[model samples]
Target: MRKVCCIFIFCFSTYTTFAQNVASVNGKSISSKEFMWVYKKNHAGVTSASQQELADYLELYINFKLKVIDARANNLDADTAYKKEISGYESALKAQKKTSPKNIEYNFIMNEYREGVLMFNVSEKKIWSKVHDNEEKLLEFYNKNINQYNGNDFSDARGRVIGDYQQYLENEWIKTLRAKYTVKVNDDELKKLAKL
Candidate 1:
């Protein structure tokens, strides 16, 4: 019957939509399978997440997306720093590609690496250079946190002191980034992920 065919077509289309899409951001589709894959990968050692925990992670994921979107909008994606980082990764991957021509895992790893490199490039431009360039500030930080170090000689502890100072700068920088960005999540779409 014509009605039966129409009903079947509708059901099939609905199923396809539900199966393929988890969420969309600024016209970008986030596939349910990919989202679930990442969720499982991140929570591999854990038993299971409560609904609240999953919801929290969904918000974090959205925030992460917003950050990436912001980074791209600001032209970080086109910057030499980001391009160089990804080029380095691609060169490394080229060596492995010879062994496995159809490696799905490498695609996911490359996605993670690309995003990581973008974030690192942004941080380097925004915070890392300032921290590294200020010798006076580094010395002041070393003097303030001198007790935390072990060796008596300042030269021996310079690396540790600089690392701690960089961490402090990074924390402060993250606060600024959080304030700068706005993140929104679609609750209806987020709930669908919980079912997976």
Candidate 2:
């Protein structure tokens, strides 16, 4: 009876100690394993990161996730263009000689590719399209900043105008996304990552 009680206690402690998520955005949990995979790959295998470093990366990761969550909310991942582009990328990777097994690296690369495509598509729709498609906004901006343009008309200063407008739009988009989502970081999971 004592042995059974000990086993129950051990199992309960094990279950309580398990933490699956490092962060959650809009109630969708981001797994600790996924965070470790991404962070280690990006930081050159620095698993034993300091707390400050972990905090900094966690903030950056949360920001990235907010954008992706925004993208998902808008159903940007369902676009046919995204599907076609990802399909092409996968085909290209498959056609090339692989250094590792097909299933392992292939899945990781595809997941990253899907996220990249989502970010690009959403950004393009919410930011880049406005700059490229709206001549009126460009003209108004050019007229307002004519002194900076050396007397060039909107046609001649379109390049500079586009760059400035794109930056402004991107800043606004990030601000809106940050305002829209609530990112919750698991301090316990983050501390564990720092110690490791």
Candidate 3:
């Protein structure tokens, strides 16, 4: 019957849409489209990928989405400076691609850029700031690892020392974030992506 056909069509479309998403991080749906964009970009020149590679990318994507969720939850997205930066970056991209606003590529790129800026801002506050704000701790770390620098003074090797400290802070921060947020991966959808 016509009604049966209509119901079947609606159900199929709904399932298709739901299946397109790979995971949900802190209640936000992360679509397979977004994952594909990042995966292809990162794994360029690879004609095909294995299931493990896809799985690894999925884990990385979930962690990144958690960071974005944290950034938005903290209102880091509302800072006027970051707002200006996103606006300027989008404006430049818009000028280059005179496509429809609803264009898939444009939307994906915009989402990536916006998330990148917001995550960077929150990370600066959470990790990088901690590394630079405590001179005593930094000096202590530098002294403890002075041999790593081949005898360079802390002042002369401050940049490298700060980088090493930043990595440590970032790792700890990610562990805390993983404990703070709940991420759900749809194994069926992820497996489907691997088949592609």
* Positional deviation of residue 45's Cα in model 1 after best superposition, in angstroms: 5.0
Range of the 10 consecutive residues with the lowest summed lDDT in candidate 3: 42-51
As for lDDT, the candidate ahead, 1 or 3, is 3
Give one digit per residue, the lDDT tens place, for model 1 in 38-91: 677898745355557766776566555655666686799998867887888778
lDDT per residue (tens digit) for residues 1-196 in model 3: 9999999999999778768888877767889888888888778845357778888888887877788888998999888998999999888988887765679978888888999888888888888778866889889989888899988899999889999888877778778888988777787887888888
Error of 3 at 70 (Å): 1.4
**Candidate 2 lDDT trough over 10 residues, lowest sum:** 97-106
Better of 1 and 2 by lDDT: 2
Model number with the top lDDT: 3
The alpha-carbon root-mean-square deviation between model 3 and the true structure, to one decimal in Å, is 4.6
What C-alpha lDDT do the candidate models reach, one value each?
0.68, 0.80, 0.84
- What TM-score, computed on C-alpha atoms, does each candidate reach? 0.55, 0.67, 0.77
RMSD of each: 7.1, 5.6, 4.6
Which residue ranges in model 2 land beyond 4 Å of their true spot? 1-18, 91-106, 133-165
Model 1: lDDT equals 0.68
Model 3 alpha-carbon drift over 4 Å, by segment? 1-18, 45-47, 139-161
How does model 3 fare in lDDT? 0.84
Question: Looking at candidate 1, what is the lDDT of residue 45?
Answer: 45
